[model samples]
Target: MNDEEARTRLLDAAEALFYAEGIQAVGMDRIRTESGIPLKRLYRLYPAKEALVTAYLERRDRRWMASLSAATRGQADPVGAVFEWLAEWFSEPDFRGCAFLNAYGELGAGPAGVLDVVRRHKAELRALLAGIAGPGREGLAEQLLLLVEGATVVAALEPGPGAAVRAREAAYVLVRADGTG
Candidate 1:
């Protein structure tokens, strides 16, 4: 296979295994086996496991944000749309909370690149929320971000989309009380 194809396959395998089983739990050999890429080629491609992890997270961030943006696009109420999207995401059978948060919890202190990616992902999410909130609602954006993150954690613990539903309702109340709903 070509280098680009090999890289994509490796990343696909890495993302699946790492997100499902935590980063530290999956090794390079397993990624090689899963991706069907030779060990030597994998090493040449990634150089280090940390590089692979960082690439996985960076790609995931792009894909995740793109999905969220697509879901909320053209909506009259982007803030509400975000929660609606979260509800659907939480209801998925493979739901396992925020991948960035999961990675942080697993290896927050181990790799600087990993931690930076996590932080950047969160900051981007917050920025998206802020744009949805519009001007004079910075505080609301922060509050909404908290609700989103909290609901994600809660949804992970409890099955279904109850947390997102409750969070959505709370968000509406906050927006209404803030005179922006």
Candidate 2:
């Protein structure tokens, strides 16, 4: 394949392996094998495993935020709409909690770069929620973020009943209490 295709394949393999397993548990050679990309090319694309991990997170951040944005676009209540989006994400067959949260739990301290990416992704998400919440709703943003993170973790661990549904209900209460929805 060409350079672009090779890059995509490498990233695809890295994302799957890193998310399915932890970042530390997966190796560059395994990524090479999974992607079918040669070692030399893999090194050229991502000179170090840290770089690959960062890229995996960056790509996932973009895709996740974009999907959430699209799903909530032009809605009457974006904050509530966000919870709806989360419910769908929770229901995905391969739902494995928030990728950022999982990665942070695995490699947040050592790799500084990965932690930065995770923090930035979460900050951006909070910012999005704040914008949707409008002015004077700073507390609303914090509360909704907590609800989202809690629901994601709980849903991943015990997805039997109404984790996302309950979170969604709580989100609506917060939004309406803030008089924004």
Candidate 3:
């Protein structure tokens, strides 16, 4: 295959394996076997497993944010739209918690780059919430973020869904209290 196809295949494999199983648990050879790309080509594309992991996280961040963006585009209540997106994500069949959070839990203290990516993703999420919240509601944005993160953890741990619903209810209360609801 061509370089672009090979790179896509490699990253697809990495995203699947790394997200399903912890990043540290999966090795380069396994990625190669999963991707069906030759070892030499894999090395040429990623250069190192760290690079691959970084790329996977970066790609996931972009895609995740984009999905939320598209789902919430043009909504009057951006905060509610965000919770809607979260609820949608929480209901997915193979939903395995937030990828960035999972990565941090597994490798937060392992690599600087990994932690950087997680932090950046979260910061972006906060910024998005802040923008949606509008002026004079910075505190509301922070509380909403906490609710979002907490809902993610709770939904991941609980046997059933509706964490997002409950969090959204709390967010609504915050928004109304802030005069933005």
Candidate 4:
């Protein structure tokens, strides 16, 4: 495999194990074994386990944003765009939790660039939601944000449609209460 192929394999392996088993449980050795990438190539690409984990997150972020953007392209209503994004997430068979949130849990409060990326991505999401929610609804963003986060976690834990339905209900109530929807 070429350098990019090896890197993709490593990230794919790391992303799955980190999400399923948590970061601490997924050591470098396991990633090497799963990815079929030699130690030398792994180390050359990512000098540390944390770096590999961080890169995995970056890959996730890009994929998620691209998917979201494509799903929402040319939608006349911004609010609908946001819901479509969430709905598509719910549609995933193995949605689990938001990769950024999972990464945050694994990394704790470590002062790494990966943490910064996670934070910034979440913040951008909030801003996007707020923009769609419209002006003078700052509180709506926070409320909807919490609901979506709750929905993702609940789905990951229970793997059911009810959690997503509940989240949508909560969102409806929030939008009604906040006058954003």
Task: Report every candidate's CA lDDT.
Answer: 0.93, 0.87, 0.86, 0.79
lDDT of 2 by residue, 1-181 (tens): 8999998999999999888887889999999999999999999989999899999999999999999989888997676688778888888777788889998888757788888999999999998878877788899989988998899999889753368789889888887888877
Each candidate structure's TM-score, on Cα atoms with residue i matched to residue i, is 0.97, 0.94, 0.94, 0.86
Model 1 spans with C-alpha error above 4 angstroms: none
Flag clash pairs in model 4: none
Worst 10 residues of 2 by lDDT: 156-165
Which residue pairs overlap in candidate 1's backbone? none
lDDT of 4 by residue, 4-48 (tens): 999999999999888778888888999999999998899999999
Which pairs of residues collide in candidate 2? none
RMSD for each of the candidates:
0.9, 1.4, 1.4, 2.2
Q: What lDDT would candidate 1 get against the real structure?
A: 0.93
Tens-digit per-residue lDDT, 60-178, candidate 3:
99999888877767897777788878888888777778889998888766778878888999999898888778777889889988998999998787624599889989998888888
Estimate candidate 3's alpha-carbon lDDT, on a 0 to 1 scale: 0.86
